[model samples]
Target: MKIILKVLLYIVLGILALCISEMLFFFILIHSNNTEKGNKTVIMKTDSIAHSKALVVYQPSLMTDSTKNVAYDLAKGLNSKGYDVTIAYPGKYLSTDLSTYKVVVFGSPIYIGQTSSVLNDYIKSVNNLKDQKILLFVTGGADDSEQLNSLEKLFTNAEIPMKISFKYNDKGNENKAFNLGSEIGKE
Candidate 1:
């Protein structure tokens, strides 16, 4: 009986440790993303003919931490390349006029083998984007690039015509995507 009680105590302690670690990771994510005070930025609206500006929206899974920063990295790089780029977080829950940007980038992390609610909301926000040059990006926690194909499908179903898309590691993989954004801006 005493041994059983000891085991129970050990189990309880183990659970507590796990919870603390998880919470630490969550706090870290919130802190990392707190790096900037976000602003609601707007670019010029594209005409019936596509414009030279671009909008990139990134939505990270609520459970994840690192995905929140990639969109900014991509945005800064594109800006360096002389692209009019705007980076917005989907959590702002704010909608922008999609007509303002020639290219709209919808990116998010894959949770439960699919895109998160943030991306879904962003997709829903776009209106009358027919023939618009859309781009898709995804960050996966455990799976492979297979997650990106589904993201592309989501854009296709939403009537977003994607010109290019790519997936990269959520941890420290930003330069390649930045380069990609620059190239996309040039197009």
Candidate 2:
């Protein structure tokens, strides 16, 4: 009986240690700043002289490039559809002026069922979003309804025409993101 009790205690302790480590990792990931040089803003201008402008803002993940790739593909799609797309990371230097943009898209990677605080803060800092055409997308292991609902709540005053989720391992996510941008440009 004594040996069995000891084994059970050890198992419980092992699980507790794992949970603590996981929580620590998540905290660090959430607070860590990404200073990658490639994360600078990129503008994709359409060939046509008459083109509407669009902005794609996203918070890139430190662990993966999937979110960044999706943002670029989305911008490319908008560019192909006669929209001048500006792709930027959420930061202090990012322009908050949305007056010139016909449409705006925001994206972030969902980690442990939560989106990045940086992206959320940037969105909140912008004013007069009620009249803007906003679209949202999240990349994660699965489509989390709770996370999507939470993101939607941030834009309560605005009309979000589309909300999409792309899995990290999904092969066609870039194409899907691009297609979404194209669809938005058509409107």
State which candidate has the highest TM-score. Answer: 2
**Candidate 2 accuracy as TM-score:** 0.83
Clashing pairs for model 1 are 45-100
| lDDT of candidates 1 onward, in order | 0.61, 0.82
Tens-place lDDT digits, model 1, residues 47-88: 324336678877654554445556766676556656677677
TM for every model, in the order presented, reads: 0.63, 0.83
Write candidate 2's Cα lDDT for 9-88 as tens digits: 99999999999999999877766533322357789989988899989998887778888889998898889899999988
| lDDT, model 1, position 148 | 65
Span of 10 residues, lowest total lDDT, candidate 2: 30-39
The residue ranges of model 1 lying beyond 4 angstroms of the native Cα positions read 1-51, 60-65, 91-93, 144-146, 156-172
Identify the runs in model 2 with alpha carbons over 4 angstroms from their true place.
1-20, 33-39
**How much is the lDDT of residue 26 in candidate 1?**
65
